[model samples]
Target: MTAAPPSATDVLIVGAGIAGASLAAALAPWRRVMLIEAEDVPGYHATGRSAAFWHETYGGARVQPLSMASFDTLACPAPEFSERGFLFPRTALTIGHRSEAGAVDGFTAQFQARGVEVVRMGAADVAAKIPGVRAEWSEAAFEAACSDIDVGALHAAYLRAAKRAGAHVATGTPLQSARRMGDGWDVQVGGQAIRAALIVNAAGAWADRVAAACGVAPVGIQPYRRTVIQLRLGVPVPAQLPLVIHIGGEFYFKGESEGRVWLSPHDETAVDPHDAAPEEIDVAVAIDRLQTVVDWPIAAVERKWAGLRSFAPDRIPVFGADRHESGFIWCAGQGGVGIQTAPAIAALLSAQLGATLPGGAIGAVDPMPFAPSRFA
Candidate 1:
C-alpha cells in the first residue's frame, strides 16, 4: 500500500489525519512537506469517525481558545482554501437534572465569563426546546453560537490546499522506524526510506507509538473509545433540534433528518490504539440513559460506530517542537476538540516551524501551555 514516497523532504508528517493535513497545508508554502498515512486513505480512523461540532465549551476552558480562534476560518475560509464554510447553524444545550442545577449554573457561568453567548434556560424553556425530555431534566443552558462542523469538507479542503502548495501525500505508507542522524532523521516507511529535517507526530491515537518508533520519548498519549449510535425514533422530532448534552457529561444527542437521532453514551473507555468498534453494552447504556431523559421511543438502532479520542497526560492538546528534540514536533493529543481547533493549532505549529504567527485570536493563544515541555 505504499505510494512512491520522496527520498528527502524538509518536513515529514506521520498520519495524514486532520492534524497532519492541516499543518501540511499551513507549512507547505514555506517547506517541502510530505504526509504518510498507514491506511489506504487519509482520515480513515478518528478523523473520519468524528461527530464533530465547533462548540466553544465542549473541550472546557483551556481548549476553548483554539476552538474560538478557528471559528472564522471554519465558518468562512479563504476562497482558495475551501469552496464553502464548514460550520452550520446548530446551537447546543447543556441540560442537567433538577438536582444538578448548580452544575448547570456553573457550566453556564464559566462560558458566559468567556464572552460566549449563552442563556440560562428555565424548566419551561428546556421542555419547549426538547419536547419529550423528562420534567426533572429542567436545568439547562443554551449556547446559540455552537455550530455543527462540516468535517468532511474541512478535512478534504486542507488536503487539497496542501497538495496545491506542493505538499506530497503518500497514502498506505506507515512509518516503520526512524533514527536521528547528524542534520536529519532517516525515516523508513515500509520498504521506502526518506530523510527529513523535521518529523511531525500527528499520528492521532498512534502518536505515542510514532514517537517510540523514532526513539523519541513518549508523551503519554492515550486513546479512549467513544461510541455513537443512530436511531430511528418512534416520535416526530423537530427539524431544528439543538444538540442536547448532559452537563455532567453522561450523554448527548441531536436530531438528524427524518425521524432519526444521533446519540452517544458519552463513555470514555481508555483503550489501546487500534480500530475501535462500538460495544453492545455501551449502546444499551446509551439507550437506557436517553430513555431516562426522554420518553421518545427508539424504534430501532439503525447504525452504530466508535472512534478514538486521544489525549495527553494533562488532557490538553500537545503542540510545538518537542522539548528535548526540536526536530520532532508533537501535534497529537487533541482529544475530541481536534477538528474545531485544527486551524489554530496548525497555524501555531507553522509559526514554530518558521511561518509568521497569524493574527487574531490565534496570535493571542499562548502556545506554552500546550507545549510538550510540560511533559518533559
Candidate 2:
C-alpha cells in the first residue's frame, strides 16, 4: 500500500523517476526527505519507457564523466544497495558510410582521446560482425564498454534504499503549488499543505512547470519524444550481436530475446510534457532506415513505444540550488542519459544538500559545468 503525504519535511522531492528516487536515497539518510509522485506509480513516463544503454560516448563529453563515474555503482554496488549488478555486457559498433569516413574518423578519434576504448574497423571486420554486406556502410568505430542497462532494477533499488532509509514515498500525490515562506517552502499537494525546508524540481519533462508552480523562473526545459520498436527479423538473431549504431545518428538496433531486435530512429521531436505514445510514422521511418542498413527482412513489428527526453536549453543537465530562489533546487534536464548517470548525479546533489561526498571519480569530476548558476 502507498503511504500518505507527510504534513511537513526537511526536503520535498518532486517526481519519483530515476532522478527523484536516486536523490531521495542519497539524502534520506541524513535528512527528512519525502518523494511525491503525480501518477499512481512512479516512473510511468520517461524512466519506464527507456530503451536504455550505458554507452560512455552516447551523451557527448559533458555527460561522459558522469556515466564513467557511475559505472562502479551499477556494476559493483555496495552489498547494502543490491546484491547483484544491474548492467549486462554488450559491445557497441558505431558505423558510417564510405562518404562519411571523415566523420567516422573524427568520432572514433574524439572518444579515443578521452580514453574510451574505440577500435577502428575496416569493411571486412564490420561485415564479420553484422553479417550484412552493404558496400556503402563500411567505416566503423567499435566500443567494447557499451552495455545494456537493467533500468527497472536500478530504479527499484534507489526507491528501496530510500524507503529503507525512512524516506516517505507518497503515490498519486502531485505538487499543486509552492511559495517561499521564510527559510522554507509552503507547498500544496494531495489536498493538504505541507512545510518543507527545500523543494527539488526533479520533475523530468514537467521540470519547468514544477518551477512555475514554485514561483521560480522557468529554465526552458524542453521535452523531446524518442521512439523504439521491437522487430522480428527473418534472419536468426545472433546470440552475441553487438549494438549497431549509425555515426550520422540515423538509427540504432540491438538484438533482443526470442530472436527479435530493438530499433530506434534516433528521433527527437519536441513536444509538451505528457503521456507519450509512439507515432506510426516514426515506427515506419525506423523500419525504412533499418532496411537500408541491413539486408535482414522484417518478419513482424512485435512491439513499439515512445518516451520523453527532457533537456535544458544548453543540453547539459541542471543541478544545484537555483540562482535566486532561497530553498529551491534543480535536479532536472538529464535528457536520455539519466539512468546511466544516476548514481553520480545523486552523489553530487546529496553533497550540495550537506552530505559528505566520498572520494573517487565522482568527487574528482567538477560539477560547475552542470550547475544551475550557468543558466542564470
Candidate 3:
C-alpha cells in the first residue's frame, strides 16, 4: 500500500546535488524538507563531472569566505556517512612565462596574505616540484596549499545524512509546476502535489528557469561549459605534483594518482542548460598548452567530458529567499565552488528558514550583492 502524499512540506528543494542535499540535511532537523531530482540518480551534472579539487585559495573574492566556512564539515566529515579523508595530497602551482610575470607576483602575494604557503619558484624549483618541465618555457611559478576532494564520497555523505534526518529525497521526480498558496507555495512533482512553506532553488544550471517558473525574479544565472581530459603519463612525475595552472588562466593540469593526469584548457564558453560535451578544439588547446611546459609524450586520452558551471552575473551565489515572496528561497549560482562551499550555504538557508540569523547564514555579507533584486 502507498502512503498518502502530503499536500505540503516545510521546505521544497529542487535538485539533489551537493547544494540541495546539503541544504536538506541542515534544515531537516527543524523542518519537513522534500528534495526533488529530475534524474533517476542524484549528481547527474556538474556535481558528478567535477575534477574534484579542493583548494581554499582558489575561489574568487566573494567565494573565499564561504569556502572557509565549510572547511569544518568537509575536513571532519560526519563519521557515520563519510569516513574517507576529505582531501588527498596535491599542491597548486600557478605557472607563468615572461608576459605573465606581473600577474604571477600579484597572485603570489594575495595567496601568501591568506596564510597559504605561497612562494615564487624559479625554473629550477619548478622542475624540482614537477620533473621533465622545460625551464626556458616557465618563467615563474608558486606552490601553495591545495588538495583533491573526494567528490563522490562527500556528496554521498550529505545525501545519507539528509535521508537519516528524515528529509524526503525523490529521484526521478520532476517538478512540473509551482504557485503561491496563501502563506506558502504549492508545487507538483512526480504526479503528487506538495505544499511547501519555502521553495529552495538549488537546481544548478536550471536555476533561472526554475525561478521564472515560480514567478520569482530571474537572477541571470548563466551556465558555462568547462572541459577536462584525463590521460596516462608514461613518465613518473612527482607523487604529489601540484595542480599547475597557466598564469593567464588559459590552461591547467593536475597529476592524478598512479601516473594519471587531468588537463583542462580553462574554457569558459557560455552554454545552455544541458549535458555538455567536450569540444575537440578545446581539448586540442589543452594538449598544446600542456606540451609547451612539459617535455612529456602525449599518450592517448583515456577520457574526456564537460560540465555546466552556473554563475550569477557577479559570480556570487544567491542564498536568501525573495524579499517580496514569502517562501521562495534562492540557493543557486554556486558556479564551480558548489562542492567546497556546500556546508556554509546550507547553514545560511537553514538559518533563513528557522529565522534564527539575520540576513540568513551568509551573515554580515551584503545580501544585495547576491539578491535577485539586482537583476530586476
Candidate 4:
C-alpha cells in the first residue's frame, strides 16, 4: 500500500506569472501557499513576450489605481532587483492624423482631467521626437510620463521574495482538476492530488479555462494577440526619444538600448488562448507604420514574437473571491498592466482575503473596481 498524500495547503495559485508570483510572495509569511505553473519555467507566456515598458497612462481609468499603487515598488526597488535607470527619459507621446484629431484631443483632455502627467505637444515637437514622421500626421498630440520596464528583473524579484518566505513554487505541474473538498479544495496536478483551503485563478491567458475546470463561472475574459519586433539601429540614437504611439493606436516605437529599437502596431485582435506567434501580415503592418516614423534603415532583424494580453469585458483586472464559490479567488484579466501593477495587486487581494501580507499597503488601493463578483 502507499502512504497518505500530502495534506492541504492554505492557498494554491494556478499561474506563476507576475500576479501569482507576487501574491505568493506577499502571503507566504503566515500561510502555506503553492504556486503551480504548467511550463518548465515560469513566465513562459504573456509575461515573457512583453514589450518591456512602464507606461503609466496606457491602461483605462479603472486601471489607474493599480499603476499608481505600484509606484514605490518600481521606483525604489529592492536589491534583489536593481534599478538600471531603465525607464530612461522617454515621454509617452500619442500622435493623430487629421482624421483622428478629435479622438486625440479627447484622449488628452480625459487624462489631463485625471491629473495624469500629460500635456499637448505641437506637430513640430512630434517631428523632433520622430524625425521622419509625417508632419501632416500630427493633427493632435500629447506627452506623458512613461518608462521601459525590465520584465526579467521584476519577475525574478517576486519569485525570490516568495521563495524566501517558504512558499512552494512548482513549475511543470499542470493542474489536472480541482474540486471543493472538506472546508477547502482538492486539486489534482501532474498526477498528484493535493488539498488547499483556497484557490487563486491567476492563469493569465488560460484564466477562463481554469475557471471552467474549477466549477466557477467564466467571466468572458478575452485574449488579444499583439506582436513586437526588435531592430538593431547602427546609427546613434538619442536616449531621450519618447515612446511614439499613434493617437489612433495604429503603431508604436521606442528606444530599447544604445543601438536598438522596438516597434509594434498596437494591434489587439481577439485570439485563441495558446502559444501566440507573429503573423506575417501583422509584421508587415508594423514595419510599414514604423517606416512612417523613422528613416533609420533596419540594419538587421534582431527578433520578433507575439503574446496574448487577456482582458475582461470592461478591460480591467478582476480580483477578490467569487461571490458563489466560497474559497475561489481571482487575480486574472491583468491585460498589459501586469508588471506595472503587480505589487499593488498582490497587496490588494491578499488583504481582501485577510491573508498576512507585506507593507500594509492594501488600504492604499480601493478594492471596489477589481472585485471578482463584478461579473456576477
lDDT of 3 by residue, 1-376 (tens): 1243367788899999989998888888888988889887898988999987766666665677777667666767557757666877678888887667788888877867766667887777777777788866455546555778888888888888888988888888878889997888888787888888788899999998988888877778899999999977777765577888777778888887667789999899998899899999998888998888888886679999999999988888888867677578888898878988887778777876883543333464344565655655
Q: Give per-residue CA lDDT, model 4, range 1-376, as digits (tens).
A: 1222346788999999989998988788768888889888899898888876777677867777678768667767666545443344357887777678788778878877877877776777777776566767765455556777778777887888888888888888877889987788888876798988999999998998998889888888899999999888757666556787777778888877767778898889899899999998998898888776667777877889999999988889998888789699889999889888887899878876667545534456678878877785
- Return the TM-score for candidate 4, rounded to 2 decimals: 0.92
Q: What TM-score do all the candidates reach, one by one?
A: 0.98, 0.98, 0.92, 0.92
Query: Taking the tens digit of each residue's C-alpha lDDT, what string does model 2 give over 9-124?
Result: 99999999999999999999989999999998899999999889899888888899999999999899999999999999999999998988999899889988999899999898
Give lDDT per model, in order. Answer: 0.92, 0.91, 0.79, 0.80
Candidate that would win on lDDT = 1
In model 1, which runs have C-alpha deviations exceeding 4 angstroms?
A: none
The number of clashing residue pairs in each candidate reads 0, 0, 4, 1
RMSD of every prediction: 0.9, 1.1, 2.8, 3.0
TM-score of 1: 0.98
